[model samples]
Target: MSTPVPLPITWSPRRNRLVLLPLSAAMVVLFTVMAFVLPANWHLNDRVAMVVSGLLFAGVGLMLARPRVTADEEGVTVVNFVRTRRLAWAEVVRVNLRAGDPWVILDLADGTALAAVGIQPAGGRVQAIQAARTLRDLVDERAVPQDGSTTAQG
Candidate 1:
């Protein structure tokens, strides 16, 4: 049997942080520098606008980097770019990360499949697989029957 995945774990995209965070910081600095270097003829409003634009870019970048999945004994919490969802163990029916899929997806009892963008293959398929398996193991271990009963029916 496969080993069980430890609980109270959090998963996020490593490659995304490595690539995006630095790029966002660099863009902010570059835009600010560019604003000051603009021709003297440019109005102060133009410089302020440029700096504001840079700040906005950084804000959006921070949001993009926020995707993450947290699992504890009670349930799973998925935080996407701008949305967060909490699902009980039984609410999840399946966990899959098929080839070419951007991220892991959880099939819920509500008949919906939710994308877990926090666990992406960009971090390497092996890592993604590990994360997927971790969640799968948790679901298998904690998920209750759809009918919410532990007893077997004769």
Candidate 2:
């Protein structure tokens, strides 16, 4: 019997959380402050627009940081900037994170590959590789054969 992996593991991009988020926050604050401190000739409406644009910038940054993957016994959920996808263990045939690739890719049974933006090397190559291995193990564990033909006998 294959040992069961612990359920409910989550993976997120460390770069987004640690680097992008803080930079976004700092930029937002700076933009807001600059809006009020601009030249006297600048109209009040222009200042408001500047602040609004800054808020929008933060929104995009937050969206980028939102990507994550939650894995459980049944399946894995991939949440990206604008979309979320759920794949059952059976649907995920393989997980690949090749060099220069932006994120993990899930090869499905239907011959289609889905980008799993949640796991990216931008955070750290080591962490991303580890996450891919964990996910790959989960998928392989559930891919047991119905017959024992592949089992080796000592």
Candidate 3:
């Protein structure tokens, strides 16, 4: 038997730092400044608190900035944070690009939605859209139809 080819799949955070990072940093800075302005006794627990809070914020920042893409003969895999989901080419119903935010909304056969972040919103180069469309077509081609039309409906 021959090895199967991989379907092109791309994954990225829905948004990179336009919202998460600054807010996290603000929280850290706010608390650190608060600790400084407050009286020493009140500040007793502040330093530790700030450090802990800062670390938490930093973790979130890192998570939000992480983006990855993987494609294999079976299907595509999109990973976000601790959650990683995959879809077989036949399982993908359609690729939707019209929305307030940018994402690859995968309509699965089981009525589930798998969204690939950052692929939406036109944030990347022109190639991003092209790549997304190509993947969409590939998924559509392999997708199983529901109404007997042989074409996957989204």
Candidate 4:
């Protein structure tokens, strides 16, 4: 039988929109200042600067509008505005969704853990717990730990 895919239950940034809003606003302010503060005599340079900065700002807005997520036969891929990562199903060792700060913890063979942020459900505690458990089971079933172990037999 074919193995099931490890899909991404949720995909988002560790820092929320509220957290990035301020920084984005600050960039706008800085860009605006640079664009307008320059002397009018330096017309060409100022115009170019303004256009570039505006394009950058627009790009940021677009990224915010569409946070990225890709899940397939292998595993989940989450793209935060700054970085993107593809996690393979076998590499994901565990998913820990705890109270107060629910997260998917990926345990690696090298004793490393990667916390997948932004997969939390909107429901109350019970729902979160259930989701966490489900993720855990999925990862557990697929992953093969080290110690020269093999999960499948011919």
Candidate 5:
């Protein structure tokens, strides 16, 4: 029989964010230029405010595009726009993929749910579902057996 294919140790969105980084940078530049070139019947504070707002917008864009999920032998790490969380493989009780959901949600043993922003439905439903399945498989492979033995195969 053929050997089993190796499962991925990590999972992330199939879509690349490289494009967003540059696009957001361009927007910031455009806004900065407009702040100086666009004539507005307003005070200096208003101009500064406009520029700062533009920068904040760009920052948000960059932050949203930087989300990622990484898994290893020990646990998984999820990096969202505002926060990063790490959960051991044992802590993940279930993986949920629902229709109309933007991303995969992980149900933890602690009665909390964690959104896997890295596995976004925006990458296409098929891809997102496959990613969720892969994550589930990883969790199963790392699960602890009833006898307190580890199930990790690699």
Candidate 6:
């Protein structure tokens, strides 16, 4: 029998900030221009502060919008707001998605739990559940069994 080939799967938050990020950047530019042109009875320092604050807001928007999780035959890559983690299938012990959880959690063989923030419940309960199930299945298909048998061999 021929074994089925595993395809790469990528999961990201449903509500992407692609639009928000660009919109925010435009707002920052608008604010910068307004800070210099608009007559609001404000001093130079106040205008400078407003421009800086707008830039900060745009930075925050960019941070919130850039998380993703990708998995393939070799391993999984998780890119969070501030950190990125890559783990081989053998390192993952199990996938955990429970009620009231904000995101999918990965239990690793090293006794550390990694949060898959990209697969969040905020997307929708049904969608989140389906993603968790799919990720679990992929992990199972790639992970080595306790009996020393590899899933790919089957």
Clashing pairs in 1: none
TM-score, structure 5 vs. true: 0.81
User: How high a TM-score does candidate 2 get?
Assistant: 0.83
- Where is the poorest 10-residue window by lDDT in model 6? 1-10
Position 43, candidate 5: lDDT: 72
Ranking by TM-score: 1, 2, 6, 5, 3, 4
**Pairs of colliding residues, candidate 4:** none
Cα lDDT, model 4, residue 8: 49
How much lDDT does each candidate structure score? 0.89, 0.86, 0.65, 0.61, 0.78, 0.83
What would the per-residue lDDT of candidate 3 be over residues 34-152, giving only the tens digit for each residue?
Answer: 66777667656777787677778777876766555466667777776557777676677777665454656767778887777646555564555665777666665566667655663
| Among all candidates shown, the one with the greatest TM-score | 1
lDDT of 4 by residue, 1-154 (tens): 4455455455444344555566667777777777777777878777677858866885686466344444555675756546777877676766766656754555655578765544544334565566566566666666766664868733
| Candidate 2 lDDT score at position 147 | 52
Q: List pairs with backbone clashes in candidate 2.
A: none
Give RMSD (Å) of candidate 3 vs. truth: 6.4
RMSD of each: 2.9, 4.1, 6.4, 6.3, 3.0, 3.0
Residue-pair clashes per candidate, as listed?
0, 0, 6, 0, 0, 0
Error of 5 at 40 (Å): 8.4
Clashing pairs in 5: none
Model 1, 59-109: lDDT tens per residue? 888888999999997899999999999999889999999999999999999
Rank order (by lDDT, best first): 1, 2, 6, 5, 3, 4
List the candidate 3 regions with Cα displacement exceeding 4 Å: 1-44, 99-101, 144-154
TM-score of each: 0.90, 0.83, 0.62, 0.53, 0.81, 0.83
Question: Which regions in candidate 1 have their CA more than 4 angstroms from the true location?
Answer: 151-154
Task: Give the range where candidate 1 is weakest over 10 consecutive residues by summed lDDT.
Answer: 145-154
